[model samples]
Target: MDNLQLIKSQQSKYDEIIEYLKQDNSYWLDNDIWNVEDKVFGEVEYKISAKNIRFDFIKNEVLKNEVKFYLVYSLKNKYLRLSKVLNEHQFAIKYVVEYVSKCLLNKTSFNEIHIDNNKWKLFLINNGISLNKNNQIHNTTYRGICSEISSFIRDFYDDREETEKDIWYSKNIKGAKIPATGVHGVNGHINFMSIPIYYRNTVKKYFKNIITKKSWNHCHQIISHLNYFFTKFYSNGYTDGFIENLLRNDIENYLYWLGNDYKDKNPTYRCKFVSYVRTFLEYIQMAQYDKAPKKEVSFLIFQDDIPKRELNKDEVKKVKFVPEPILKQLDNNIMDLDRPQYIPIYILLRETGWRGTDILNLRYDNCLDPIWNNKEQKYNYYLCGEITKTGIAELKIPIRDKVAEMVQKSIDKAKDLSTEENNPKKYLFNTYEGKLKGKPLNKQSLLNTIKRLIEQKDIRDVNDELYHFRLHSLRHTRAKEYVEQGMGISIIQQILGHQSLQMTVHYATVTENTLYEKWKNTENLDLFRVNTETSRLEQVDLNSDDGENLIRYEYVKKNLDAVRVPFGVCFKPSKLPCKQQMNHCLTCASFCTTVENIPEYEEEIDHVKKQIEVSERCGRELWAEKNKAYLRLLKATLERVREQKIVHKNGKSREEV
Candidate 1:
């Protein structure tokens, strides 16, 4: 059946179940059973409805099972149909049906269901609802269902006042479709509702407006602080009265308490508490009090009183690209994958820098066939998806033939599996088996799979340091490769689907070692001369009288700032530093160059002479003069290094060797 019709059908079936369950003055599953002789005497009959067909098990004496046995048999077909329409809740339905059936059978008759109402509620609370094929129930909660069943039992079976409305602890607030009762939802909100009526209403309104997970968490934290406030100071009286006497000092004192009492807590937490509390006060002041600035009625404004902490430095540093060697290992292992299911995903991530979320949720319909590109002169394929973090929709990743081929193969695999009953046809990548079978492979699942394949035992960095293998590292690795290939920041930003250039800039971390290497090759004179066999070290006897001047010259050379430039180093002391600090270093009195560096200078002089000749031939006399002047400086430096011989500390000139 189509989805809408199927939904209607399932709802109808649930209505039937609830109707049958609530029949008679007492509800359907009440604990009151007739004797087995009732059926023989035609006093009691067991019947169930499915697909508009009624099946009576009481007449069929061949099946002498109890209430549970007949109930399961009667409803099993209906449950299967319901399960197909509702995949996520299939386990819950199956569990409830089977559980109720078992409870009925154990008592020997249908009337015993009334006696087991409390037991059933306890069962719902403890076992929580379901056992699905995918084991999703364990990752889920039944707090809402528990509260519902508890209320129902109390109102119908027991003799309790039903005046109180259900004050929900878990709900899908802030337009969230699914109820967030997981770790993100446990933000002390239920406790917050126990505060003064005025405070409770305000807090509940704020919580309902908080749409993001982060906002909800922050609200939860603020509620926790309010809890502490109610418990510590106004435990005996209504907190609303305390608000009248509240002063600026009280708020400051609370912040101070948070700082001192939770001294061991992370400083960031303290800062967040101050921030959230301040926002809460502001929210109350405007939302309820009409933006009045009265100290008595208003939440005391103390901007300085709020705790502040700087963001961690390590967290700020970005662009931690994976090393090439490690990436090579990853590629080798990934290509050798026997499953081939994960290969396309890894390659897409490694090559295209797409976030794991986008890749995991990739749809078959979003991919397009390879099209010819005049610029690239080759066919390129595209995969379109939405960026969940930024909400950038229809973001397309242009793929080369190799990556396209892998994706096409995966698409074919998905299509082949989609023909099977209940197999997913929408998601391109899905697990065919296991608890998560037929479901799109989640980010964590893909991460675990990749980690298992690559890191057999332990993942390590390029330096052999222990490293955590993350899927994000693949994106970073791709970013680094793009930067190294001279791709512009804007181009990289487009490729990575970054809305801001600032984010793209963070991924351009060129390591200090890489910077130093580039400097050595292009700018450092020491490296330039060293490459020409220039000997920076010379022999000298420490005991000789001449060695003192040698030592002084060596000290002068080591301390010079000329190592960074291309013209050569200067031998000068800071006590009597060179007057020429710029390009004039070549003509300075203390300028120095090794004999081995003479060839490079000579080659440069020859190139300049040719340039001068060409400039004169082209009738550019000014350009010729400029080249000639540069040649003169070069020739002078060469002549000085070649002929000059310094006298020793003893005043004896060295031999011309």
Candidate 2:
């Protein structure tokens, strides 16, 4: 027999099994027929039936206007009993019928469907009946026992019109070209088998040898619980309901139980459960096509009404102090020969206000001069280093005076302990005992040492962890001090190398007491309380170049520069060069005559020149035109003084004071 005859013979046997299932009263019958209305094959009907004993089948119209039938028997039931079967066989039957419909009407191939159906038929023959040499099913010598029944159904029922030849031909051709289902070759199959086996064994070995036995046992217990649930509740003998129930109702209850009951007993259990659930979901995702559920299950929990700790003034003062003896001990220990070389590290933290990580990673090369130093102090050292976690370029911090002195002292001490050819390229805190020799101190080691010191000094009442006392706290304290002293926020930010003002603000703590004290000390009471009616004078333009002015602009400029007057002072020079040149009015013999000659311009010129000179010499850059204008004003005042002197001499010789 050819392929068509064998297919027909197999269909007959499947129909017989369907009849047998229908006759049994214990099994449920569902004659769910899917109908399709097509332009070519009008009213195509596909019928599916399932029984509880593991037998299910589908009947659909074939290409030649004949009814094609297929059946499946579950392997779990040895006696071909359909009642004990799951929904898998029924689902498979539906897939096959749908696949055949697609092939006939949509002109598509169903390779997986075809392979599955073939396996089901083979399974049936191997377990229930036998096939002859010609590949035709035979039951008690009959070639096709259910052929008459199939013919009757086809003749009386199934009134669908035949699909067109072109459509049928396209579908058949497409179906024939379907790809293979299994591994490509023997090597592929071997590799596929070997990889999974190797992975399984390796995982088992790791769990057995590497992980704690208790952990391994716990995982096994969980898996056993899942397996027990699968055997008892799942219709398909799989842990399907366990996952469904976990998603539907148990998750919240489990979290609650963890929070209330197991919160302290097994603090990590809730987190572990969440992790396990995720792992299971991921496994399912890889094995099947289903979405994982999303829910909030936090790992941390705390009492709802917790209060923050705040220190009062006296308590703060007590915490801030280091006893005289303790300070002396620390100083001596820092200078000691046998103790750990942590003095430099501690001093650095106290001085530069750098974090532990920053200090640990500090290079000798980074301690150079700053780009802008108005004081012109050569002892100033700039700290340029990297932030540990972020790995970004941090700002350079300037260390001068006390801080620079401490750093240099530490460097000298470190170098003295080393051999003669000591290079400054070496870390300022290099030692024999620490990691990264010729480099800075280790952050953790430094933290540990400080923590020990704090403990020894009994100062760790609030914060016991030395690591928690960040190196950045030094920076914060310094910033607070600067802010309290009336330093500009921008300057503090530059010193701290903070990119944002907001961050600098966090470190800065302003107090009203400090502000009041500053106000009391610096503000001038006389200036503020002056009576305008008595003290006010006529406003004079300092930019004026009046020649008759007794106070020369040059004299005022020289006096202002000599006194090193602050910006914003007010004064002007004499209009003419005195007979006693370069001499002040207090020492000049011709002072009285000059003063009497140009007394009107004296006060104005004095005030204006002083103001102009001081304004030019302010901390900020001075404009060239402003400086030149002030110089001309001074020269014009000198000329005015000279003209007045000559006029006075021509008029009369006045009496002495």
Candidate 3:
């Protein structure tokens, strides 16, 4: 056994495949053919009338047997995704089988029938399967065919040495790279040979460090970035290692080439690629490792290196969400979703605005947290889940009772189907049947299912075009709704699991009407004016809207430049320029501020103190004195601003203060 290549499974493909099909007879339609019934598929759009999906095209008996074995196995286990509506999958399998039969004949068993990768390529090419990026459906079909054939050959056959030779594989790892939605994408495969042999050690060390601090998903992206980097690095035929001196021309040329190559990709893709390279360069130098670039982070990469994507008003509204009308249409037709497990997932996405991945990652045991409300005598519901993106290991955000109820239902459904091997995490949206048994529903499957619904139902947006939406658009729509509802920015920040307020701000796109209404209905403003003749501050009642107050309001708008200031607005008319410096406005008798500006006053004090220290350090004696006097004036004004709100509210006059 040790002499032979390490056995992933000792049982032959026929041993179990025949057992599952012939013995059980559940997956088999006849002795040889099979049926992928309605229950076998998810994301199905139309009526599934697929029957008699025959595999008799294979001329060789053993090869025919092998084909049935793998197909039935995959069907029973629910592993690889088949064609939509289960028709294309049939065609794919049939074509592959017919091609194999025509190419190789007279095989007693698949053990005797060894087909190399070149033959497989030739067979795919003959069927019009292309490596070109144009047709995603065709590409996906290609991926499925290769996956089924490669996996079947590798898993069942005794040709471990031969199979491993063709595609990269290790002893324990079943296969390398994940199945791409298209044939071209990869999850995690770092070809070290792609890096120059001399510089390979440095990148490997960077990866080792990365693995400890980041997920394999991140590593995959970095590997892609480096793949391009070293490809250019090698093509240049440079004598020195990996931007060793961080030459400006070298970095700029690679970036220029990268921009042209990745122009079609999301703008951030180029940014991430360059940023990742910078990180690698920094990591090597920081550790004093071999071939360290030793350059400052900004020296090689500037903020402007990555182009910013700023959508216009109409574009923002267009791309940021799927309109509610289309959403409601989707909601109504959600039960028609091909994956029944995904119904609740879709609802959660629409209602809660959580990322689809997080919704799918919801656990069965502890997903619903109901808090008892004493006054209302009801349990406030929270959907408990891990938000891995922001490193929120376990977060429970408020959910309406309906969302909670739906989550509980999904949890109940998941519990009935969970097995230790398939769903150790007990993901609520899990497959109980087929090759995906116990696995969380693929995120792509969720998206593809929705796409099927949109196309099938012909859901159109307000613009009267076919509606297309990304899953994350649901989250954005939800955030925008929250902001429009006047939900606090801080609360929205927490609900969306945003790492910073800046990200939350991006979602706070209020409609012009809402902004106007909010501005107009403000009943309180501690607005004040200056009695120019008397040189005293006089508070005005803005809500009164009397002739005097209206004139005062207009005056403030037209003269005072009173909309806002560093701490407060200048009560003195703009036409009369103050003799004092702008920063010294707080000391002016015309400075009128509200209680809300207290924090601003304190922050400015801190700023002034720091400046005073800097002035003293530079031996600017008179300048320091001037700052000290300004500091005194600032404190006095802060006190007066407080006194105006506090004392004036208590019915005190200016003389009393």
Q: Which one wins on lDDT? A: 3
Cα lDDT, model 2, residue 515: 58
Candidate 2: residue 45 Cα off by (Å): 88
Model 3: lDDT equals: 0.64
lDDT of 1 by residue, 1-657 (tens): 597975575455444444554433332233233222322212212332221211232332211122223233223222222222123232343334445456555532221233343465456646655545643333243323322222323222222221122232333233322211122223312344345565565555565555343333444556677666555546444345555456777766666667766787656556766666566666666666433224533347456655555435665564367776677777777766545667788888987898786687676666656677898797778777756455465677687777777787877877777645435546788766643455566666567777676657355775676556778888878887777655789989988888799888877555566567556433422222222366555444555666666555444433312211243333343345434532465655455466778788877776666556544533445445655666777777787667753312322232343
Worst window of 10 by summed lDDT in candidate 2? 182-191
Candidate No. with top TM-score: 3
lDDT of 2 by residue, 1-657 (tens): 597975676466445545544532413233233212312112223432542322224333232122222222111112112321233433333433444454335522121122333443454365455676757644421222222222323322222321211011111222121111101111110011111221323223322332232222243434333333223334333343244224434544444544554354443333444444444444444444233223322222122211222344454454232323344444455434233567666776655555565566554545444455567744446666654322335557776566666666665666566542443345555544321234445555565666666555554323443223444555666666577545688887766656688767766764455557546433422223334788854433434554224235344443332322223323333343333223233233443445454554455456555544444433211332344444454456556567766333334455432
CA lDDT for candidate 1:
0.53
**Rank list by TM-score:** 3, 1, 2
- Of models 1 and 3, which has the larger lDDT? 3
The clash count for each model shown is 11, 29, 6
In model 3, the runs with Cα more than 4 Å from the true position are 1-185, 188-205, 211-216, 243-246, 262-266, 294-298, 309-317, 324-343, 371-380, 409-423, 441-460, 464-470, 516-547, 551-657
Using TM-score as the yardstick, the better of models 2 and 3 is: 3
Off by over 4 Å in 1: 1-197, 207-238, 241-250, 265-271, 276-321, 367-382, 394-401, 419-425, 432-438, 455-468, 479-508, 519-523, 527-657
Each candidate's lDDT (Cα)? 0.53, 0.41, 0.64
